[model samples]
Target: MEASAAKAPSTLAKASRERRDIVSGEVMDEARLIRFVVGPEGQVVPDLARKLPGRGLWVAADRVAVETAAKKGLFARAAKAKVQASPGLADQVEMLLRRRLLSALGLARKAGDITSGFEKVSSAIQSGKAAWLIEARDGAADGRRKIMAMARKQQSAPRVFGLFTAEELGLALGGENVIHTAFLAGRAAERWAEDARRLEGFSPLLPEDWREEPIEAKREP
Candidate 1:
């Protein structure tokens, strides 16, 4: 146990070393930066998984930073070679992040780390077994309000994500009209939460018009 504890600080110290953003020249955690690589055609491609083989050019994950990088030829400058960044590069990155987030949600569902429907979600939240509360963007306002009300009463309310439409959630989770879903507390939930948080950099996790009292949930350290 002593040796295991000793290794953690070293691991964290390594992670503390930040990557430089090609666009802003500012350093930040890799998690907050989007990596890009020059493809065979010399086109800039987002390396969302950071496993693409090649020298990586990083930019802050914000849309404005991505747009600025693409507009200013920052990728080409960083690569020290001719590269093409499509005008829609920011949109492409957003799509990739959304796809990855949904794929993580699908995996969570197959692993039985999620529950759907109003009653099951409500129970999970009330029982303190939920790590995330996913509401369809098109779900009824009344039902969403009631769910949030229950969450507010909990000692530790689950984080909420209401960005996807009912059809999108349904397709990802292999269900029809999956308006309300609860991610059960576990490893699978933790992985999905990380993906969701990453996507939040590109898109709002809640609907733009969602107006209700926020539930204060404990965030990951």
Candidate 2:
């Protein structure tokens, strides 16, 4: 019990990053913060990977926070320069994050660290070699339920995420009916988990509360 309690913050510190919201003057973890950088034309751009080279501007992941920051000229003040914040900045961020996640998924497939279809994914989970489970938002209920049940029976359950639709998954993976995807235990899986979590933070539509447990089907209501 002591060890479990001691590890909570350490787990969080490693899973997510921390930054200050320029709009509200509040410190927010990666789960609640969206990072941004100024482009060559002085336009604010969402840095979802946090790899953009420049001073970062952070705001709460909420749409309201992004809208306020752009409308109120808070970014200009934070950067100490005439930076332009697009009125459509929030929409832009969502689009960028969405694409980034799909791209990551594609890369995982190319690296052979991701497998689609129910049978293959189930095998991966049962083998204790899956680090993450991805269910399509439009997948059949029974398929998702069986996968989650398998994940739960594991001694160390893998994490679960449901953020994309069947169509999106199919397009990204170059396949059809991609109801479920299991990320094999490897470097690519780790990278996918990071980007997936960031996308989950920005999009409330994602099933962020789902985990590898014997549970009902997880999806956006």
The most accurate candidate by lDDT is 1
Candidate 2 TM-score to native? 0.74
State the lDDT at 37 in candidate 1: 96
Q: After superposition, how far is residue 65 of candidate 2 from its true place, in Å?
A: 4.0
Clashing pairs in 2: none
- The parts of candidate 1 lying over 4 Å away from their true place are 1-17, 216-221
Local accuracy of candidate 1 as per-residue lDDT tens digits, 15-94: 76568999889988787788899999999999989999999899888888999989998889999999999999988998
lDDT value for model 1: 0.86
Q: lDDT per residue, candidate 2, 1-221, as tens digits?
A: 99999999898877567778998998766656788999999999888777899999998776788999999999999999999999999888778878987898898898888998889999998999988888898777777888888898887677776778999999999998789998888878766665555555456534655443423234321
- The per-residue C-alpha lDDT of model 2 at residue 174 equals 100
Best by TM-score: 1
TM-score of each: 0.88, 0.74
Where does candidate 2 stray beyond 4 Å? 1-20, 24-33, 51-54, 60-64, 205-221
Query: What TM-score does model 1 achieve against the real structure?
Result: 0.88
